[model samples]
Target: MLYPNGWFAVCLSSSLKPGRLRTVAFMGNELLVYRTRSGRVRVIEPHCPHLGAHFGYGGKVDGENLVCPFHGLVFGPNGVCIGAGRSRTPPRAKLDEWLVQERAGAVLVWRHNKGKAPDWEVPDSNMAGFSAAQEACFELKGYSYYGPENTADATHFMQVHHLTDVAMSHEIRQHQMEVNLTASWFGWQIKVRMINYGVGCAYAESELPAWGLFMKSYSFGTPIAPLKWTYTLLDSTHVRWLDALPRVLRWPPQALVGALMHWLTVKEIRKDFRIWNHRRHVNDPKLMQGEMHIAAFRRWMMQFYLRD
Candidate 1:
């Protein structure tokens, strides 16, 4: 199948500074991500149209445009060549520009196999009073779809996480999927809500309201090569005492609580890695009654796969 179409988080917004260019590899393509002098981010095809010089290497930012190192040609944010070395800009000198947006502390780009515009937008984490407190980045030897779709696997909670009394409810809407899970974890009642936007990005919030503890996390999966994917996990926590108490009194407890949650979240991902690494894709399988959502998820994912 062709690459799924949607918004993909390429890198953290803080990683790219003004007048800096970086190369990112995703979906079997190399992209040049740069921030202009005016603090605007742009994602474009890496090669310059003038002489096919790669813009990711030795590229200079001239105000709000990118200067190719080969002949000092300048290309504007719209990917149109604006100037050349003492020469008029050619009518056909242009590079392809991808749609980019900065949201939720990350740089996101819209990707479509057929070169179509984005049909939906990713939700901003700040709007929900959430911030990334911990982040983990690593490569996984599996397809990109496995990570986000795992949320809908209801039976995996008891088998993988050792949670009891697991109950899951799923709500599917246009361009989004929400899964709510209520379970018992090591004697604590846990409620987890996961929202997936497209196939590559998802956000989850887990709360233990009785203890005044809450955690919000975002997960992104991007394909770098054939059967090789990169997964980024960002976790944030909100504790009532941390906000209500004085800074001096809150420092110790806040750090300890946040560290504990981060550790457990990392451990869970490690367990998932073991399974996803060796699992094979089965087009047709005899599934039990409880596995109905898995089928529905596959059907929903078909919309993103555009065939030529």
Candidate 2:
């Protein structure tokens, strides 16, 4: 499948501090990500238009501009070259800037095969409770579309995760899909509400009212190469009464609870990773009656892909 065009996370917001630069690979392209002294984040093609030097390796942030290490060339956040050592700015001397958004403690960049502007924006980071402390990344051999599409595959809850009494319903909107799932996990009833915005980003919020536990998780997948992609998962957990308890007494137990929840979520994804890593894409899937949404999801996903 062609890479889906949308906003896809590249790294955690915490990873890039002010006046810092980092290199990241996304959608089969190398990008230089940096934060200006003013605290604005920028994503641009890594190669310097002056002499083809990779800026990500030794790029320096000068106030709000990026300076190339190779020849001291400077470029602004808009990617236009200002000058190099009092020299005149050359025509067409600029880097390609990508549309970037920092949300939910993650850095997301918009990607279009033909450089088209993003049609929709990522959801507000404040919509759910997410913390940078609880996050994990995994490298997997699979298409970038698999993770978000799997969220609507209702049958997988019982077959893959071993959850019982599984029930799921979904509604598709202009730029997002909402899925609600109710199931029994180890005798505890859990309800999960997930919203997939395009194929690159999805957020799932899970609640266990009986246990006073609440979790918000975000999943992002970006293509690194053909049949290869990187998947990142981040989640934050809160215990109901713990928040009201005395700080001194609640610290240890709350930490333990959050850690356990994070571990369990990772374990569940690892199980799915195994299946996705080795499976082949079946264009004409022999799905059962209950698997109608799987086909519908595929049709929706195709809209994000560019045609020749």
**Taking the candidates one at a time, how many backbone clashes does each contain?**
0, 0
Per-prediction CA RMSD (Å): 2.1, 2.1
Q: Weakest 10 consecutive residues, lDDT, candidate 2?
A: 124-133
The models' CA-based lDDT, in order, is: 0.83, 0.84
110-175 in candidate 1: lDDT tens per residue? 988777888799887652433336777788886888987789888888899899998888888988
In candidate 2 the C-alpha lDDT for residue 283 amounts to 83
Name the candidate that leads on lDDT.
2
lDDT of 2 at 285: 85
Candidate 2 clashes between residue pairs 3 or more apart in a chain or in different chains = none
lDDT of 2 by residue, 118-161 (tens): 77987764533222247788889979888988888988989999
- Which runs of model 1 end up more than 4 angstroms from their true locations? 86-92, 127-132, 247-256
